[model samples]
Structure formats: structure tokens, C-alpha cells
Target chain A: MTADRPLRAGAGLKPEHHRHILESRPDIGWFEVHAENYMGAGGPPHFFLERARALYPISLHGVGLSIGSAGGMTPGHLARLKKVADRYDPFVVSEHLAWSTHEGVFLNDLLPLPYTEATLALVSRHVEEAQTVLGRPILIENPSTYLRFEGEEMAETDFLRALARRSGCGLLLDLNNVVVSAVNRSFDPLTYLDTFPVEHVGEVHLAGHAVLGDIEAPLLVDTHDRPVSPEVWGLYHRLITRLGPLPTLVEWDSNVPAWPILEAEVARADSVLRAAGEGRARAA
Target chain B: MLPLDATQQTFAHALLRPELQVPVAVAEMVGPTRERRFAVHRNNVKASLVATLAAKFPVIQRLVGEDFFEATALVFVERHPPRSPVLAEYGAAFPSFLGTFEPAVDLPYLVDVARLEWARHEAFHAADAASSSIGSLAALADDDLESVRLTLHPAATVVASAWPIVSIWTTNTLDAEVRRIGPDTPGEIALITRPDEEVFVHLLPQDADRLIAALADGAPLGEAAASVPDGFDLSTGLALLFSAGAVSGLLEGMSE
Candidate 1:
């Protein structure tokens, strides 16, 4: 469902900043939470979420749906997500286009899936199932990949477009993922974005990455532990310019800074969004 | 080309089991450096799972130190990967695993400490319930009290340990003050309840454990007190429950 108000720049909600958010009620456009964290029967997570929900729109960003698993989506996981979505009435619900669970074991990381026609059908069906079960269209995000599988039928963007078309789901375009995957696989981030179906992009994610290995053969890890790098910001600027200011989120999951630092990142994203909105208006 | 199911199963095997060769489908894509690139996923998966355990059991990690905890947690991760995608529910089998672990045998109290941490983790996320106030109980007629079963809040949990787990958990987590535990230290019964948004652990006194334990099991006030030692005071137990917000409701006509 569309938000009551236009979605703007936001940050990932963390327990460390829950009280600060509720007390300060900062000028964040909205907040997002990992749906798995709130899957428990109920305590502080629900407590803070209820308080935050009253003041701001929330997006339930799920990290554990394993939507690309070959075996199919877990009914139990979808049920839990539906429960949380119903309880919080999140403005948007999203999951990664990667699998974390395999053969009854949850690897707990968004493992990449090959973009094959068979895999495409599987993910498309799974996304459709999640949307039907949640009774709201879910947003699927592209994952950062360190390696690609051989014998893939299409590019990652093509797979996402097909999945969106088949499932009628929107996209959560994570710019940092684009930059990381591009650097790791030796491709241009802008080229990947050019092929991306921008019309289906409902939300945009901006986060930081750590450069690992030597400078000669660098690997960009989507660590989300620090401030957004300038390169990702550039890609974000490009994204909003083309896509016209979707709901952008600044995610700092690990080594999270204090409220002011995260607020600053959100502020940075809001400025880009405002600039893009202005540019779009001027052109119109 | 391998089917999608085989490719995923092989990939998962490679990530979790280093002995297995990198899935052939993945190897050919990245050319010669596929193994190292695949190791990134392996490292990320292991590190993320270890971090999840570390967050859930900070006391255990602190007691054992970071390096030891990570090494031990890696073993736990391999043996018991999460069944659900919810990382919060991942370590239900960890405390028991620690109990049987050979390396941690020296620290006999480690298992109980893990249990206490797990209990707190569970209480932290357990369902919220409106606690029964003393005023609510005051309205109950004296004759009906013996047969009325008091329901404990969903977040209420009692962890009984033959070791001084409460003192160990408190001194390790909350305080800088150092406390030593010897063989002669008394065992403890920790009552974990989330009175508000914060979960707190209180050491039960005398027979309060038996009484509260019984009450949690749907024992009425009189019968719960009867299960405790002689000279068990129902008023003291009731006061503790009310103060802790452990009692959620009174089930009328329900008795032990």
C-alpha cells in the first residue's frame, strides 16, 4: 500500500537509537526495521516499534525471507512476516533477491542466486506467494555479489525486471550494492543501473562499504558499518536523477554511530532527494 | 549446467564445509580466483552467524573472552545452523551444546551462564502482556483466592542454577566490581521478568523460587505456597510477583 505521506529519506531503525528516535522524533522521513528482529512473541522490539510507528512510517526490510531459494519460500517465515506487517502496518515491506536458507538450514546471510530462467520462475513464484500472503506488494532488493554463477541465462537486472513483471512487486534499489558488486566483478555501476528497470524501483538504499584486499585487486564489502562513501553517493545521485526521488534509506547496521551521525547521513540523502525533486520540477 | 537446486546445495555445502570443492558452476564463472571469491561468502556467513551469537550471549563471550567465544561459537554454528531465518531464534540449542562441549568442561558454570543469557534474550523478545496489578488482586474475594490461578506474564522466566549464575551474570555484565565465586558459593534461582521494556534478573529468596515456579505452572496461590518449604509466606511471594509485574492475570475457578 502507498504511504499516507510521500516517502522521503530515512534510516534503518536500531535498538540503540530507539529511545533517541522516540524522544527526539528527528526530522527523518521514515524508519525501517529488519522484520526478523521483531518476529519474537514481544518485548522491547515491539515496544520501541509501536512508539516509532506512532510518529513515523516504517518499512519492514526483511533479511531472512530467502525468497530465491530453489525449494520455495517457507510458509512459516511468510506467516511471521505477515503477522509483523499486520501489527505495525508498515508502509512498505521488502526482501532481498537472494536465498539464505537451504535444505532446512538457514545460512543467515543473503547468499546469491544465479540468474537462470528456472531460478527466475522459482523466485517469481516465491515473490508472488509472499505478496499474496502478506496481502501487500513486497519490494525485492538486488544483493551484492562477490562472484557470479556460470551458465546464467540473463543479467541480474534482467532477472529483477522479469521478477517484478511476473510478481507485480516493486524494487528496493540498494546503490551501495551496485557499487560493491561492480567493483568486485569489474563492471561499471552506472551501466548496471542503466539496464535496471527504474520505473519499478519503489525504494532506494544507501549504505557504506569497506574495501578489502590490496589496491591492485580490491574487493568492496557491503559492511554498512560506516558513513556512505562518496562513490555510492554519486551512484545514489545518478539513481534519484533517473528515478526521481524514491524513498531513500541510509543503513548503518554494524558499528553504528550515534544519532547525530546517522541523522547527518539521512540529511545528506534528503538533500539529494530535494535536489532531484527540484530538478524534476524544473524540467517539468 | 547443474540445475538450480543442485547448484544451491553445492554452494551451501562449499560455504559451510570447506572440505568440499567450490561448486563447479561457481568455479568456472570467476575464472581462476573463484575459490578466494567464494571464501568471501564463506567468511561473511561464518562471521555474521558468530556475531549473532556474540550479541545474544555477550556475557558468555565476555566471560570466555572474544577469541575463545568466537572459536567456540564457530563450532556451535557448524553443528547447529539456524533452522529459522530469524537469528533471534537461532541459539535455542546453544546452552545444551555448551553443556556437552569438551573444551568448556573446565568452566562448569559456563553452561548455566549461557542459559541465563538465553533466558534474558528470550524475555527481551517474549510477547508483551499487561501485568496484573495488586489492585486487581485486591478485588478478588478471600475465599476465591485459593482457587484462582495467577497467570505469569509472557516475559516471566525462572532459571534455577546450581551455580551462582545471577551473581556471575550481574558482576560480568552490569558492574565493574569484581566478584569471585568459589565452590562454597550458594546456588541461585534467577527470576527474569520484563517489568517494563527492560528485562531485569532478580535472585529469588528462600522458597520464593518454588512458589513462583509453581505459580507459573498455573498453581493457585495457596497450592503454590504449599509446594514451598515450611514457613513459606504467600504474602512475600505475592508482593514480589506484583512488584516485578510477573503476574499477568488471575484465572477464576482455575486451581492446582
Candidate 2:
């Protein structure tokens, strides 16, 4: 998959755009899919994915692996993920750093985890297990946190860097998540990126967020329902300029718009990527 | 500091029970803003699960109004969270949960309707299998037909209900025309099959349900037809199975 040139900008694959994508064959970089949606035995999801796989490079972004859970990963879930990975041979396989299942109950949402030694060890162990099962290193995306945990611990960046070092897995740095988490926790997004170990980043994610709570003290929810916000787009430009161009994705999960609208987002990302490449070439 | 397991358990408890305070470790990070920050995670968990259930049981949601359905779904979400990561297979226990729910007792048919929807959901995701051609069966000798045991398609499911659930499901899903079902409506037996790519729901004769059920349980054709009620036409059942493309294969004498 990497035998060609570097990865390019893509969009999160939605079922509504499957036919249009196949028919139009747009110039987007690639497509990403939620691994859980394709875990079924067989159906239209698989039917469309098979055709899409033939056309573009596919990335498997999983939401429910629960890598941060202390109980360890479920065998069944791991097996199903392996089945999908083996079938698609995805160009990149990624999962969140958050845990979703606890005590046999799946919350269906990515729950936050505390940045502590215990969590680092737990997450690393889980990542190692997943890599062993999949026979390939998977990229772990930093989660968008709503709340933080109180404890003597390392910073989230240090924890993720250590996790990558220990498990030999790369990072999927979601720029929108950084913006949301920074705004929610009252931190500087640039400082967070400055301290981030961007060398380990294998991919980048850009998505939209919703502003909630009172105006005096609002919170940014990573809703992924609309176009990438201006602030998030600015962050994406800065990150790409710093780390050079990485495979970026335009994720609009909920309230997905028409084909042209989503394609427009991808085009915007592609343009930024080209500009970033030009700047790097001039500097070199 | 609480152990990792204890912290997770406490967080989960707080998410499910609003009255409970956020775990001390989690609460301290936000200071005075803890309540609002924690509510986001709580709301996301509930809202996502409720949406999942609503998608799986749309007919039930329509049968009950939107407000009632959301309320009932929230209750169900609290009582029974998903046990699997696969959202498509998340609400397997909902039909039984609806049967015991207090508010839904007045609408007894609602439980069966949920069951029918669940059946269709299952059939839609079941494994793909090629249906046995009628020519393959025609090649069999007359003497060999009775001893053959037929296998239904992997995606085929038979849901028998004491209420007219087939009509209820079709009327609500296929047509927008509102029509009230009388209390005297007869019972129904629905056969859900995904012969090719699309899932289809066909209402079968009352006796065909028993015959199909027996055949699904690995009974030979002769014995399965004999077990049906007297005057039950075996040919009709065979025709229904063939037309629906539900029969996947046939084995002689039930031997592997």
C-alpha cells in the first residue's frame, strides 16, 4: 500500500455516498470506514465496501476496541476486527485511545481515560495484543475528552508517546480533537501540538464539533456533524506545515451532507496538502 | 487514588445514575465545571444507545409516538446496556424487555411487532448462501423425495405471532396510509428471507409455519409434512419455500 507516494487527503466513507463515489470516481485521496459497521456477516455494507475497496485505498477506523479498558480486549471483538483487517488488507488500521466497554456493557461512545501509569500500561498491553493478532501495527488516535481525571500522572502527549514507543504502534493525530479538548480543558491548542510527538503520527483527522453549554463557559463536542470549523482548519494547516503532509481524513459522521458538499471538504484538504508540500519544498 | 477497575466502575455508575456524584478522581479535574463536563459523556452514551434502538425498532417507534418511544427506549437503555460492540446486534433482548414493560402492556401487539422487526434485522445481516435450484430437486426420483431433508437459507427466519404482526409491520413500513387494525384481526406467520441482496418478509399460511419450523429443525420432508395439521397442503408450503428462495440445500436421510 505504501509502495506508491505518500498518503493524501480523504473523507470518511458514508453509505449515502457509496453509489455516487463509485459512479463519479472523484479525485479524493482515499476513504475511511468505521470497522464496527462492516463487522456483519454480509449485506449491502459489504457489497458497497467491496466495490469501494477496488477503487480507492481504504482505512479501517475502529470506535469500539476499548483499548483503554482495564478488563482487556474482548476475544470476540478482536476476532471480528481481525476478520475485517484480513479481508480488506486496509492501507491503515486505526482505533481510538478511549475505552467503550466495561464489565460486559458497551457504552457505544468513546469514554475518556485518565493519563496515568496504570492506563499507559493497560493501553500498551492492549495495543500489543491487537498488533500480535492483526500481525501489523495499528495507529491509535487521541480521543476528544469531555472531562479529565484527577491523579498523579503524565501529560496526554507523554502518555501517547510512551505508548507508541512501548507497543511499536503509530499515532493518528486528530486535529479537531486537539481543538475540542484544548477548548474544553482551558489549554492552548498550539502548546499541546508543540509538545506532541508528531514524528510518530501516521495519519491526521479533521472533523467538525458542536458548541454546547452556556456562552460564558462553553464546551466543544466532537460531533462530526458538519463541515470542519475554521479554527480546526487552521489547526490542520499548522500541523501539516509542521509535520509535513500526512494522510488526512474529512470526517462528517452525523448529519452527513450531499456528495458534492463532502467532496468539497476533501478538495479543501487536498489543496491545503498541496500548499504544505510546496512550502516544505521551498524550505528544503 | 482508586484502582483502575474501581475508577471505571465508579464512572460507569455515575453515568447511569444521575443522582450519583461523579467519581472523585474524575470530578477534581474540572473543579466547579465538573457537572456540566460529565454530563456530556452521560448524554452521549444514552443518546447513542437510544438512537441505535430506535433504528433497530422503527416500526415500534412509529406504533408508539416519538416521545413515548424515546422515553421507553431511555428506560430500556438504563436497564439493559449493550453487551456487544456490534450495534446492529445490540438490541436482541428488546422484544422481551418490551413484553414486561408496564406502559406497553395495553398495546400487547407491540411486543410481537418488535420481534418481527428484530427478525428482519437478523435476516438482513445473516451469512450469504446460494439457494438450491428447483431443477436440483426435480432431478431427484419420486421415491427419494420423501427422505430428503431440506436446509433453509442461512438468512431465513420464521416469526410466528398470536397477533397480525405481518400486516402491522407492512402497513407501517411500506405504506404511509394510516389504517386502524381492529382487535379481531387474525394471527400471522411471517417468513423473513434474504434470498439475494434484499431482505423480504412474506406472510405464510398458518400451517406452513409449523411445517417450516419442523423442516428448520432438521426433520425430513415426509415427516415434516405429516406433522402439520390435517388437511394442510404440503405443496403450498413447498411452493412458498421455493418462491422465496429460502431453501439452500437438500440432504438425503438427514445424514451429514
Q: What is each predicted model's overall lDDT from 0 to 1?
A: 0.87, 0.87
Cα lDDT, model 2, residue B132 = 85
- Candidate 1 lDDT, tens digit per residue, B1-256? 6888888888888888878888888844433278778888999989999999998999999988999999999999888988888888889889999989898999988888899899999989888888888887888898787778888998888888889999999999888886876789988988889977889898877668788778777777777768988876677777888888888888988533
TM-score of chain B of each: 0.94, 0.94
Clashing pairs in 1: A41-B127, A42-B126, A42-B127
The clash numbers for all candidates, in the given order, read: 3, 0
Question: Which lDDT value does model 1 have at B54?
Answer: 93
Quality of candidate 2's docking, in CAPRI categories?
medium
Chain A TM-score for candidate 2 is: 0.97
Best by lDDT: 2
Candidate 1 regions with alpha-carbon error over 4 angstroms: A1-7, B28-32, B134-142
